[model samples]
Target: MKFKSAFYLLFFFSAFLSFDGVAQNKHTFEIKQGNFLYDGKAIQIHSGEMHYSRIPHQYWRHRMQMLKAMGLNSVATYVFWNHHEILPEQWDFEGDKNLAEYIKIAGEEGLLVVLRPGPYACAEWEFGGYPWWLQNISGMELRRDNPEFLKRTEIYINRLFKEIGHLQITNGGPVIMVQVENEFGSYVSQRKDIPLNEHRSYNAKIKDQLVRAGFNVPLFTSDGTWLFEGGAIDGVLPTANGEGNILNLKKAVDQYHGNKGPYMVAEFYPGWLAHWAEPHPAIDASNIARQTEEYLKNDISFNLYMAHGGTNWGFTSGANYDKKHDIQPDLTSYDYDAPISEAGWATPKFDSLRAVIKKYAQYDIPDIPAPFSTIEIPSIKLTRVGDVLSILEKQKSVQSTTPLTFEQLNQGYGYVLYSRKFNQPISGTLDVSGLRDYAVVYINGEKVGELNRYYNNYTMEIDVPFNSTLEILVENMGRINYGPEIVNNKKGIISPVKINNIEIEGNWEMYTLPMQEAPDLDNIKKNDVFNVPAKTKQLQGKPIIYEGVFDLSEVGDTFLDMENWGKGIVFINGINIGRYWHVGPQQTLFIPGVWLNKGSNKIVIFEQINSELKSEVKTVKTPVLNKLK
Candidate 1:
């Protein structure tokens, strides 16, 4: 019997090579018209973005091992959808807002992933990534096809594709490409010329609802290669993201047909984010390592809009508008002076783009991951105990007496308190016709006034005394970045509140302050109240509190410089580190070392300027104050 059929044909060829090495260790991924095949071959992604709620799940595997030691085989996130459903049906992946363990630790570091999920994703985030409770419903028309914005963008793309569509890459996982709604042709166009075709049938109905909620891969859009030939689709894969070169990426690969297959660049801006007084915006890591060595010497495929610009942390940052109308608002330190530096460290443009991506990477690159861990805390003091109108006049019978307007008190994000009872306290020019950026004017509580939309004159007049009760408060201090007039942003006084011009309305009292529920102050009364003041004495002002204490046994996360303090708000152990303004671009204030508490950690600081010299707690792990330049 021929030696027992050669021992059953060598045991069936050794069990078919051990089941094809367990299907290539199971993290599949295959796609064609833009490459990315994997276990089946054709690869070349190089991705980077980085945003697991802006980095901090214990530094997400030290920022995905410094993006795979810079040769970056893949990693691109966006997820946001209001930082993972902040409420309505509540859902949060995990601490530091874990988006599926930052995509299974970018597949335990081997890499490969590219999600986006949007619901909008303008990247400078907040609102651009939608979800301020979807602007309290009621006729919301964002990114078109408005049926309450497609029923909350199909319930946040079907609960984020049922928690990250089985981790993509064709189900075995590690994604591969998901980006459907991000750059909608950089804000939809093609009207009278007609081809808009309902924005390509709502992005082919979100790619047939992500292949009927399963996402089979091969689907791409990206836009901005001269507006991707009227927002591409015809069998998907258009690509081209921004700041082009190489003959504009070979005319976007001769408009699809020549099949350039995968030449991404989905953002690339090495640095540029600031808005308020506008001046600090630096970018040269040798021109982002000579435009990333001309996109890896033309093998082209990019990402980097933020290789690690972390910390939009709260009120989720976003705003940009330049076609000269100016606008600007993106500085919660998404330090897109990228090449990783919002505290994951590694900069000099991350060693000049990791030596030009390890000289055009063919393979083997991993080494760079060490940095994260800093503690300075020198001299530490920042005291200010009382005022915010004396805690709203001791909670005037539990607040909200009407005047509400940070969108009818659903209160989107921090600071808003209209207040008005002016029996006739006329103070000449006090106009505020839609000042959405910064204002602090009082009368009875007495701080006289101040208004600034970067000095575009929001009308100011002093000395009002008489009937007393004017209080303005208004401090969105962020929003309006690049435009089609951001649907007229509109915050407080978008068209009212005049004094000598007479229209000061009455009985107003709205104080929403969506400080997202933090201020409980344990029934007030805590009196150790330190005081420091007298550096030369200049503490003569409106509602100042400032208090400080620090012994921190050790918890983590730091960044609180707020550039020499001027605008207000900073609280720890009591929480709220949301607002800080020296005006010319936001200046650092993230705190969250899990909200610090290893021992003795109070730190309050209201400071609208009763400036007696305290503000100095330097615990940096990088938020780039450049020592307030």
Candidate 2:
């Protein structure tokens, strides 16, 4: 008995020693003179950007392992301000939204970290990563030095710092560097011969705020290599952000410190983002491999903008400008054709990058894990629960105080309802001046008007046979992408409602439909001709709401394809899947299967446009929506 007790004691001591070794092995890194240092030793940082909310939590460790094997020493991530504190004072740190777990996993894989906690990250994200709730604030000017903007920004920064401040290298954590504001130079100094003094002033204010908020690590500003000189602040390190090439890198080194420090590429674009209606972008893997090799050969530090470009998911994707004066919003799939594909699979680019990194690594290359399995789903059907229009009638209290324009209403995230009573027969051009995007007009439950932003005009001649109540429901759809005109993105009717070239002013009831509440179909009315359905009911074969049961018995990672179905929302068990439209470009929806249950998992879909198309859900396979011919 004494011998056995001695053996158990020895085992406990051994386990303690093992844990201590692991704790010692874990390192915190710092950036000094453009080079990251691990425990006072100069180390090159090859980082990649992968948001925690974008990729599945189960895949976090796997993706980090892949990044480490590919010769990357760091994982650069953006802590989206809106993603955290999604609701007021409500914070989520589990599943895919687990930011701390992501960083901790990077550390476990023997990689450092660069945290880009953007109160405003403009990563082609919705509202430039700012919370949609801020738009509800009256006269809120984002990215400016306004008190309201600063107050919210301060709260976000303070809260985020509280969560991850001690995680920085200075505090014995893995975070090496923190970026102040992303690509500010490009936005502020886009025009020729424009002095960047204002831009610098704003940056200084941001830097001061961050420092005061407890981000003491080395702060860097990233801009395109050629444009670095214009946006560079004196004390802060200026890093190049774009495709990693020799000439541009050399130029960045010169512009940053004049040959006094190491060179770094903050945003090495492995692949470009795609906008709707634009051809899907495909970057050559061979070119990326060659550029990565060149950077490694020169001992330059670079971070792939998106090592694993996951899904924009929900209404979080942003828009961009095209050549035809069209404002193109980004698709749901953020598959930027990156080294690690959206599904977290290692592509040919991944292998090539691994080879290049292995050639220069002082340590042995780790084993590349096998790709995750794919499961194909059979076709199924979906049903409509009830109409959305009738529900609006129940909430007659949704009307706001005082007749408010779209700007005054300050409802920027979802749909808006504008209703007014027309007392007499009217015949003239009914004009909705400054309609932000799309609007549907109805008179006494008859669909009489439709206005779109394609032509930048929202005018239609209407014949009101008698006194009737005119209701116009306008959807924000999304804001404009290109040109200086993007700043004036006001939803609903921006100007005024007019008839016969005269402004129609009366008791105009404006309903703010931010869609923050769960949709209810029972509240809908058949007389309500405008609203769509809320829930689906059908359950059978083709076009049937496919109800499948699976045992997640173990939590893992996977993606969901949303391209095959029409416009509708998805739900896990009972949670809303957000909205998915088969409208060109965005073909797949991301399902971080990690959020699923071990047994009896449920998926409910509500397809708005197509009732006959078959829909399926798979565990392993990623869905790709075919373009409508």
TM-score of each: 0.36, 0.82
Top candidate (lDDT): 1
Candidate 2 per-residue lDDT over residues 1-629, each given as its tens digit = 32223222322221221111123333444555545454555555678888877776777888887776676767898877877767556776667776766776776666667888766677777666766566667677666556777777788888888777766756556677898877766766554333466556666777778899899888888877777765577777778888457676676666666564557788888788876545777788888888887887676778998898887765567665544534566666777878988778888888888887766665556787776654443432332333343344356534542335555664546666677777888878988866755666777645575776644557898877677877777766555433343455566777768888888776777766665444443345544322212323221111112333454554444445665565545666554434565665656565655556666566655443343434345533565533532
Model 1 agreement with the true structure over 1-629: per-residue lDDT tens digits: 32123222322221222112112345445555555455554445667888888766776888888887776667788777777777576777778776766787776565667887856676767566666656566788566655667777777778777776766655555667887776777566534333477777777776676677777776677767877755676777767776658677666755763555656677777776655456667787887888877776665667877787777755567676564433456666666667777777787788888887666554456678777456656556654344556566445422343444576555666777677765655667877856776677877766676776655567876656667777777777555533345555545556666767866654777654555544544345543232454431333456556666777767777777767667766777775655566763557686757667788888766666443455565656656543333
For model 2, state the Cα shift of residue 166 in Å. 0.7
lDDT of each prediction vs. the true structure?
Answer: 0.64, 0.64
Task: Report the alpha-carbon TM-score of model 1 versus the true structure.
Answer: 0.36
lDDT accuracy of residue 507 in candidate 2:
74
Q: Model 1's lDDT to the true fold? A: 0.64
CA lDDT of 621 in candidate 2? 57
